[model samples]
Target chain A: MDRQAILVELKKVLAPYIKNKELLDGITENTNLITDLKINSANLVDIVIDAEAQYNIEIDADSAENMVTIQNCIDVIEEKLSSANS
Target chain B: MHSAGNDVVAFRLTDPERSAQPRFYNQILSPSEIALFHSGALPSLSFHIFLWLCWSIKESAYKFRKRYHPDLVFSPTAIPVTEIRATAQQITHEGPQNASTDPQITGTDHQITHPVLQITGTDHQITHPVLLITNAAHQITHPVHVITGRTEDLFFRSELFPEGIHTVVYRHPDFKSVRSGYAFLQQALGSNHPQTNGATEPTPETQSAAVRELVLLDLRKRDPNGAWSFGKHKEGYPLLYRNGVLQPVPLSLAHHDQLLGFSYLLPVS
Candidate 1:
């Protein structure tokens, strides 16, 4: 529900796909999924699906496209979670 | 300013069963694209290849436009592939009388045959024909699907291979001088390299370096005396420099799984 909690969950979701464990350990809000973690673009969709299942929320195409960075993913998830709760 | 972009998708890394799921592909394809898939237009191709082909094209188009629009985000649904059609490669026969005078016909017996694809989109139009030549010595009759699509004003041509798919997007039709190529990442990285072993996987940094090396090697062959170097522009687009001077060429680099792809616009002589 909180940013830190969301990040923890996000890390768990991303850990399997990331080849560089060091980068994942040092990931920040500014860390890019493609450029930073070197996650394949094709795998981005899988991340989205995993995040959706983890958060129990649906991500539209617009929000999914903006999930290029860690912060972007958190923001979208938070927005979706709040909207669903409301 | 003519710009070019390219992307490659390797078959080994991607999961075909996962990609065919609606929940997965729904985020990637526009509503119209979904309709086109069921429209029987691509009846022969599997859903997995079709989906990845579209993904590669949109990725290339995003790169092509990113040079001009630095703030652009990649939205696959936003940049749609409006049309896709398969056409046979045309073979022109030149008679001896006109063979010498015809500039288009290079040899006396047969003309070059190309697998052509015509694609039209909302904001831009592209016609991509993969030039496969047939001569007295060899005949290449394999049909290649030429997919042309546009993102904003850019046009792209994509070729599907048994290994994967490669797509290249450019600014305009007149920028037909845009050329592209792809190679297996393992082969490009060198067969003797220790990392080439199956025990260790290739990192993105290593893959990027290998593609840059491959491009530079090809460029050096064209201009042997020029000192060639590859670097990125301030806008984060890959570029080439010769003798410390930035070449007018617009270049793009992409690698996925085991395939490395690069495309560049040739400077007018």
Candidate 2:
């Protein structure tokens, strides 16, 4: 429901795809999934699917594009959750 | 303005089933592209590879346009693949023999036993040997698909490989002067390059360093005596320098899993 909580859940969703554990441990809102974590672009789709199932939210194409960074992912998840509740 | 961009998708690292799921593939491919896929244009490639091949093309086009539009965000469905043509390349190796005397096969020491694919409509050519190594002679025929696509006003060309796919974007067909290459990260790093600085680790930092080093190596091969270096433009795009002067060459680097890809424009003489 909150940004921090969403970040924690996002980390769980990303853990399997990211190969660098050290970078994962230090991930911040500014951290980029492709550049910082070295996660392959192909895996980004998996993360999106995993997050959709994890949070029970539907992410459209526009929202997925913004999911490039950790903060952006949190923002998209938060927006989707709030919109669903409303 | 001269520029080039490329992207590589290592299919082995991708999940074929997940990639084909409607929920996932829908986010990437538009309705028209899905219909195009159903048209059986590329019958040899699976649905998942088709999806990723389009993604690689769009991603490369994005990189090409980002030089002028730095605020661009990559929305795969927004970039469309308008045309696709497939051709089979039959490569046969009987045994160790003399390499082809064709000048087009520049700098090739390995032998090519069969005729290469010659596609019409575009100036399709392979300046480098298709098979880098042929220790044991064998025969095989593989399907290579050429895809043409556009993003806004920009156009791109892509080729499918056994393991992955590569795409390059250009403003015009005749204006497309970009040369591209792809190799395993380990192979690129295995070659001694001073930029590695003796660092052999496969970290994200080293991965990017290896790409730059590989591009520099290619540049040096073209002009042996040129003093070359790599730097980034103000818009965050990669650029090359020769003899302390900024060269007009635009460079794009991409690495995923163990694969590394790069493309650059040759400076006009």
Candidate 3:
């Protein structure tokens, strides 16, 4: 899947937990998942679960630790998606 | 340094090398953590709630005694330097008789009664200092204190240490199905359940739920209706759990909240 497509899906996963967080409106590829968007880590949990469902992959503890930044999360998702296809 | 939106209150705590710096340091709290408190996701405790406790008696020690909101110390990152028993004897033999002659310290020598943590004091090096948490609710049930309401004492002390290892007197009767770190702690501490051990086993979902319930219980006044409430409680602040009893988790597998970053202690050794 393309980067844009994955980011769009990411937004949907983040929607529920980030209430009134205008940062969501400005979310972009460069956006930092926690710092920029103001999305709580708890919400990030929901995002990961959502990510697994959309891409049909599993995120383990060690690998998940790398998803600190938005770009990092996207990279992980892309990696997962690509692997699934191969 | 300012990555996304984390209101990074930069502190020098993480680096052991700078542990000797005379300057006081600060650190940034994570985003989800910001949501936990500021969002009113958690409640705040009022002085009135602690009216009957010991800190209430030592009015002078309260920094601002007559004031409505008395000042309380919130020291986090207190290092767990093995068991205090071994360390205490060593210190006693080496130190002077007036171990707590710091004239600034007041009241019934809280320094002695409390447990000592080998934390990086303001001076910065990882050194031993006694933790004198005077919260009325914590440890009230310990046999010595003879305080009532087992659950109340247990819940407050639960704030300091995660649970397990050190046994506190009061045991809060927690309602089931609660979600939060505090809830998990209560269950973990109370749990002698065959399969689980505090630091050994990863905190199960059941334990997290227990922690959440306990957090709500500690800040009960703010969360009158329980879980559904969505806003900051009294202090209108989402202060980071000072010691970070939980933290720096792999944001991948766990929910930000569920990640349980280097949070409160569960006794590793």
Per-model TM against the reference: 0.81, 0.78, 0.30
Q: Residue by residue across B18-123, what tens digits does model 3's lDDT show?
A: 2222121111122232233234321221111111111111111111111222232211111111101112222221111122221111112123333433333222
The alpha-carbon deviation from the true structure for residue A63 of candidate 2, after best TM-score superposition, in angstroms, is 1.2
Local accuracy of candidate 1 as per-residue lDDT tens digits, B106-200:
11122233333333321112233232221121111111211223224455566654556677776554334765666665556666665555557
- Tell me how large the interface RMSD of candidate 2 is: 1.5
Better of 1 and 3 by DockQ: 1
Off by over 4 Å in 1: B88-151
Q: Judge candidate 3 at residue B204 and give its lDDT.
A: 37
User: How many Å off is the CA of B171 in candidate 2?
Assistant: 1.8
Q: B103, model 1: CA deviation in Å? A: 28
How far residue B232's Cα lies from its native spot in candidate 2, in Å, is 2.6
lDDT of 3 by residue, A42-68 (tens): 234446656787778876543565676
Error of 3 at B45 (Å): 23
* CA lDDT of each prediction against the hidden true structure: 0.69, 0.66, 0.31
The 10-residue segment of model 1 chain B with minimum total lDDT is: B134-143
Which pairs clash (backbone N, Cα, C closer than 3 Å) in model 2?
Answer: none
